[model samples]
Target chain A: MSTPLLYALTGAVLWGIGLMGLIGLRHLLRKLLALNLIGSATFLILVGLAQHHNGPDPVPQALVLTGIVVSIAATALGVVLIRRYFHLTGRTELESEVPEAGRDEEGHSG
Target chain B: MSNWLMAGLLFTPLALATVSLLLGFRQGRALSWLGMLLQLLVSVGLWWLVRHEGGFYYTLAGWDAPLGIELRVDGLVVTFLLLTTLVASGCGIHAGFYLEPDRPWQRYFWPLYWFLWAGLNTVWMGGDLFNLYVGLELITLSAVGLVALGGQAEALRAALRYLLAALLGSLAYLLGVALVYGQFGTLSLADVAGQVRVSEHALLMRPALVLMLVGLALKTALFPLHGWLPPAHGIAKSPVSALLSALVVKASFYIAARVWLEAGVAVASQWMAQLLGVLGAVAIIWGSWLALCQPRLKQVVAYSSVAQIGYLFLLFPLTFGVEASVSLHAQQGITLQVISHALAKAAMFLAAGNLILAVGSNRVEALAGVSHFLPFSLFSFGLAGVSLMGLPPSGGFAAKWMLLQASMASGQWWWIMVLAGGGLLSAAYVFRIYKASFLERDEQDHFYHPDRRLEVAAMLLALASLGVGVSGSQVLSVMAMPFEEVQ
Candidate 1:
């Protein structure tokens, strides 16, 4: 098997794992990490797939660079929002994740 | 002169965003007024140029396509550009008076607003797939910032959900772009379309098209995936909600439609189009039903947006596999729907804001005695509602009329029923608001009158929505102009 094809297959597998984590995780922080993993997987596949066919390419590499910067910005913004939410509500999980009794306390606090 | 106009169209919002960040809110307001006037002129100038001179590609920084970024200044794109200028300026003018001037956090609003505007223009003209992805992120970040500006608990929660959903959607789209580049060895959408037309192995790229469409559909908040939209749109300040519902969501949908129209015919299956159409129909019915149940005024408006967006997805089924004339009618219909919905929705949100301001509460029950004190804003809301309900002499009616024609011509009678049912459901919710306001409550009059400018801002948008119905033919004529290929 070609080396680039192997890399692209790895990316596809990682993308599946990241999707599962993002969907199954309840904690917002974990969810953010899962999103980051997905980002890495997408970038990997982009570079791998482009290079697998042709010998070398600069365009996909450039796209991956931009994608990384965008993901970083998104993560930073997510952290800020999550921190503020935690400070206000004193909880890390979303409202739907909490049970009935916890929601009552939340209603009172809010 | 035209080159300068294009440059101005691209430069003004970004420059003003930077300048606005440095100044105070009031100072930013003053500067933004001048900036908006310049934008309006530039947008209109470009629209006129594209109409008369034909559409052409503008290679950014002298770099050609498939290698560097290019801006596609076509009939449909310039039409959206003009629509953005009109709707965004209305919201901007309303925000100036509506936001509390003394609050320190309010200063951030202008910068975010302009950045969102810049992002929107980029998406409209972006010819390269990667550039559109960047544009989508720019819009998502700035919009999330706007929603979370005050940083209250509920606002933060809504903003977080919005951020997550938007990020996920963008990544899905980027994944598709990666596959397309791998297959075609080019990131330019035009180049990919050209190749897909001639290539025998085009079926290999069908998964890529589906990924992109699903991503954009999620971003557009099409049904079942629309969970994140209401909380974010409802919780944001009125002007922010206006911008979000009217423009931000449409940006993603515009890209999706462009992709589908350009290359979908070659690679897409019939079931995919039908499935999209089914989802759109369900969104219309379910979203309107949910809108009717919301207790808060703005939530109803927000949910209404979800329903209206469903109308846009109908473009997919109506156009795919249809005759050329049928598809043309469907395209014209959807374009009118987008423009009219933007104007009417903006008007409704601004008017609802004024109503909430007058009553000092967001609940529908609290609006019991509002009609007596604030007939003007209520009337504006109702006028916008008329358009939403697809009533006569409104832009929404004109759009639905063409859609009905296209569906009939295509022998797809089922979508016709969906269209009619969606309109009736919308009327039910719109009237619910009216009913609540008309109930008499015996209490001392404690209403606060909003600024005259806010009322005027909303009233103007409402009037424009009605006017678009009369001028629908002229707009369609412009959209029919031929494209001049890249040199």
Candidate 2:
């Protein structure tokens, strides 16, 4: 197999692992890291597969660059919100993740 | 003139976003009025231009497709642009008075609101797959900002969940874009569609399409993937909730429908189409049932949104592998459903906000005797609910009528049951609200009164939802205009 194809396959494997981590992890910070991992895997598959077929295409490379900027912005926003949530509630996990906090489903902070 | 109109349409919200960020709430409110008026005029001009001149492609910075981004100024796209201007301006007007301008964070609302508007316009006009991804991200992040604006614990928690869900969806969609580019070596949706139309191994692209659809579905809050939507929608400030429910979710669904329509004939199987329809059917029944059970008023409305969104997915089954006329009918029905739902839901949320403001509580039981004190807002809520329940002389009814015809034409008798059952189930939930408000209670006499302007904003949207039923044919004609290429 070509080098690019091998990279794409590795990306596919990483994507599965990242998705599982995202779903399985309860901590918000760990979830954010898993999301970043998924974003990296997607960028890998994007550039790897495009260059594998077309012999070094710039379009997918450009797309990957834009994707990186967007994911960073998203991650930054997530961190800010998670930090604020932690400060206010003093909990590092989602309410749904805790069995005791399930009764507050309809509770509004206001 | 048309080029200038396009520039104004695209540039106004972005400029407003930047300018609003530097201004205080009062100054921002004054400036946004002018900006909204300019946007409204530009949207009308673009709609008129597209109707007379037909659709054309607007390349950004003189770069053609396959190398640079292109904006598709099509009939359907311009229609959505006008719809966005109307619904967004309505929400903005309500936000001006609804938000307490004295709060420090309230200043941030205008900037985020304008950014969300710009992002929505981008999604409607975006012709390139990667550009659409960026636009979707822009919308998602700004929407998260809006949801978390109050900085309350529940609001922050809801915002985090929404952000995480939206990010996962975006990554899935990006993966699909990567796969499609690898398969076809193009990022422009039009170019990809053209190639898929003639490609011998079109089935090879099915995986990419499925990934994109699934991602868009999650963002759109389709059933089974909708766990993150209610809290986010219910916990946000009223105007923010109106904007999120009215337009944000529809943005993702719009891209999915565009992608499916352009290439599903070549790559989709009958089994896949039927599977989507079945899921939609379940969403209608299950979502409505849940909506009926919710104790909070906004939760009920949010869950109803889930059910209403299900009606849009019938487009997949009705169009796929069907005749040309059947597909066209389904498309028109779905478009009408989208337009009407946006108007009605915005009106409902705004009116519900007024009711909550008056009663000083979010629970449905607190609405007892609300009709006595706040008859106008309550009336507006009921009027919007009329459209939601698909009653006569409403746009929702017109949309369902068209869908009924399409299902019959396509010989999909199974979907007929879903359409009828969903409508009745919606009526059950809507009336539950009506019933709660109508209960006469003498003990709850103390109530707060909202400004008259908030009621007017909501009433106008509710009227539009009702009036669109009569004008449905004209809107469909605009959507039917032929495309003309321009250099």
Candidate 3:
């Protein structure tokens, strides 16, 4: 198999593994990490895919560059929100909170 | 002048947002009204230009074709563009009262609100794939930030969940784009569609199409993947919820539909479209069931949003499966559904927000004595509910009628059952509010009156939905502009 195809497959596998972790891991931090892994995998695939179309394609390169920036911004937002969630509830996993109303103890503490 | 409208649509909000962020609260509040007014004019002008002058496409700088970015405006784009502008402007006005003009948080609110508007407009008018990815990120980030503005533990947690969902959705969408670029070697939708029209590249097409569709489905909050919507939309401050339910989610749906319509239709098989329709059917049933069970008023509205979105997905199969005229009617029906929902849902959220603030509780049971204080909000809520329930002389009914007719004409009676059942289910939830609002409670003694201006702001959108219901032919005509061109 070609190097580019191998790299592309690796990226896909990483995405699968990351998705499993995102779903199975209840910790908000771990979920965030899993999300970032998916990002890294997608980016790697973008780079690998750039190889398929004769020589270097600037479009996929440009796309990867933008994707990286977007991923970083999303990661930053996730971190900030995760920090707030931890500080408030003292827990990393999100409890569905469907019936958790009438309680603002954590909110008041902050 | 018309060309400038497109650029103005993009840059004006962005420029105002940046300036307001630097200037802080007082100046930002003062400038946001002007910013909204400017947006309204530009959006209306864009619709008119596309209506009379035909499609408008603007490329970045002088570079053309596969090399540079492009922004295209057509009737389809304009329909959503106008909806975004109107609801956004209305929400901006309401935010003034909701956040109070003098509060420090409103400072954070204005810039992010404008950024969200800019992001949505970019998505609506985006002609190319790469630009859309960037806009999706902008939208997800800004919207997540807005959700956290509530700052309570619940709101903050909801914001985190929202951030994760949107980020993952967009990244997955980007992966698809990478494959699509690798296949077509072009980023522009027009160019990609043109390539796919002649090239039977299912090897490249199927994976790219499924990846993109699933990604967008997650973002659009279609059922099964819609776990985060209720919390995110419910916990945010009213204006943010209004924006999220009314327009933000629609942005991703618009992209998915555009891709499915313009490019994916040729490549995607018949069953794929049918599967999407089935998903819509399930979302309708599932979402309505949950909405009926939710204790909180906003959560019901949010889940109802999920149900209403299900109706839009019905367009995919119905459009591709039937006679040309049937397809035309389905398109018009779905467009009407999209617009009316934007107006009605935003109005409902604004009114619900007022109700929640006045009562100091979001529970439906707490709506007792609500009508005594915010009569206009209560009245407006009913009017919006009329549209949501697809009742007579409302936009929802008009859309539903067309859909019903199309379904009958096409002989697809299964969707007709789904449509009628969804409407009945919607009525059940909407009536729950009315029933609770009319209840007499001693809490009426301490009720806080919602602002007169905010009441009027919410009322205006409800009234607009009613107006569209009666005079939908023009909207249909304008929507046809894009349809005819596509043909």
Candidate 4:
């Protein structure tokens, strides 16, 4: 129908795909990426939808903008954690492969 | 003056948090406690005023909704405000002892803690979708920072996963708001509800709902989307974990419930409600089973959170189609469950933190002689567990009873079974901890001694859970007052 509605549908489909990827993937980084993708899709949909209500709904757009900034901050934090996990246990998956003593020194297993 | 009060209530902690960043690692503990004390006082004063006045609403900069921001102070918001402040106070005091004075990361923890507090308060007071989004982001950023504050390898890793999940959730919620805004041209909850027209665009509305619900579900850690929680919560410091579990997760659920109610979406297919109930049932069963299996004491508590979240989800089916008296009862039950869980879970985590400090290990099996060393902490832990198990004279029991009645009255027999099963599972995990704590030991081994002050804080919260149970009728009356006009 409307262009804004079309964009919203596209964003929704992308989000669905991202969620599926997140569930299907085993790699921690891949899961994070999928989550990021899904987040972007949601933002796109929201911004697109806001376009139809008026010339531009600053409130929803502002909210989504805030969401993007926060998402980036969260992603940065996640990346740092991933790096540390790789350094400590030499693995990214949460499930443990190391011995109990090794895990104690590194701080966690799962 | 009202606008100033509302603004102060929301921004003061945030300002303090940012200022603490300048003070850095050296005075982190001192500043944290100072900030927390101020927050506690403000929250208490606000609670008293709201209780006396019934409720209050502030239009930001004297601008009305659909044009400018609005912050509403009601019984529900005040109740949550009280819980957040109490937990922050306890955590602040306990952290002073829990953290080593010379630790490098203490600098970051204080600011983030306050920032989280600010975000939490904003969520409680926020009256519209856009304001909620801002609140949620502030919360997400600060919470992620706290997770990473541990600075250890696992803490960093857990923080990363947590951040990713939180971002995804925010995105979905943002998208939903955009759709609602495009259709209705308003971000205020009441405005959106009044102008909502879902007839012409079934295709658009369905997807929007799905995105928002899925996003929030991820943030709330409702069963299937809960992959990030155990690791993130378990690896963080004890006080941080306590705050995250007890208060942070509840924020997303509160927003979701608010949207669902305010949107007045014609109770989307019965299947959706059933699906949510089914997932909730699974979470209750699965979370308990996982908690029972965890060797680490903190992991056990973390997994227990998964099960506890299930009880919150049970509200969906029980409250569906509920109107008038039944709606009032459901609302009361849900609010009680939320408040009771916050108190009990925070106490449980604090007690567990004490035990871990005393025993010098997080392993449950190694806690054989902890009761001898930390008797007060253990006692409080048991009290909290009683609430968790939904036993008589506890708030958990009251919440469960109300939900059970709602289900029966609605002819939803299946949900009754789910509730009973969840309660039994809750009892099993709680008793597991109790059994561990009480096991008789041959040799008395002296481990590290925890500070008496922390023990007192944990015990106080545990007692609050019991108090909520005893005063259930009064608390429900307060929670019901604001909603009466809506009905």
Model number with the top lDDT: 1
Candidate 3's TM-score: 0.95
Quality of model 1 by C-alpha lDDT? 0.90
lDDT for B55 (candidate 1): 91
Report lDDT (Cα) of residue B118, candidate 1. Answer: 94
Off by over 4 Å in 3: A97-110, B101-103, B482-487
Off by over 4 Å in 2: A97-110, B485-487
- Where is the poorest 10-residue window by lDDT in model 2 chain B? B478-487
**Candidate 4 wrong stretches, greater than 4 Å:** A9-39, A53-61, A83-110, B24-26, B197-203, B264-267, B482-487
Q: List model 3 lDDT by residue over B1-487, tens digit each.
A: 7658866888887898889888777678789888878888888887777767788677767577566778887787887887887899899889887786655666888889989999998998888887998998899899999999848788887887778778878878988987887677788888788898888644687789899999999999877788788888888889889999999988898889889878887878789888999999999988998899889899999999999999999888887756878888888898899999999999999999888888888899999977777888999899999998899899999999998998889888999899889999999999889999889987355887777888888999999999889999987777767423341
The TM-score measured for candidate 4 stands at 0.90
DockQ of 3: 0.43
Indicate whether candidate 3 or candidate 4 has the larger TM-score: 3
Total backbone collisions for each predicted model: 0, 0, 0, 3
Global CA lDDT computed for model 3: 0.84
Docking class of 3: acceptable
Query: Judged by DockQ, which candidate is best?
Result: 2
Candidate 2, residues B7-71: lDDT per residue as tens digits?
A: 78777788898999999999999999998999889988888887788889888878887777789
Cα lDDT tens digits for candidate 4, B1-487: 4445565677788788888888866576776677677777777677666666567667777788766788777888877887888877877777777777676667787888888888998899899887898898889888888877856666765676677678768877877777666666677786666655445554445555676787788899998888788887888888889889999999999998887666634535567776787898899889888888888998888988988898887767666675656656766788888889898989999999999988888888778867777889999888988888889899989998888887777778887777777778778877777788778777748789888998998999899999999999987766644532331
Give residue B220's lDDT in candidate 4 (0 to 100).
95
- Global lDDT for candidate 4? 0.78
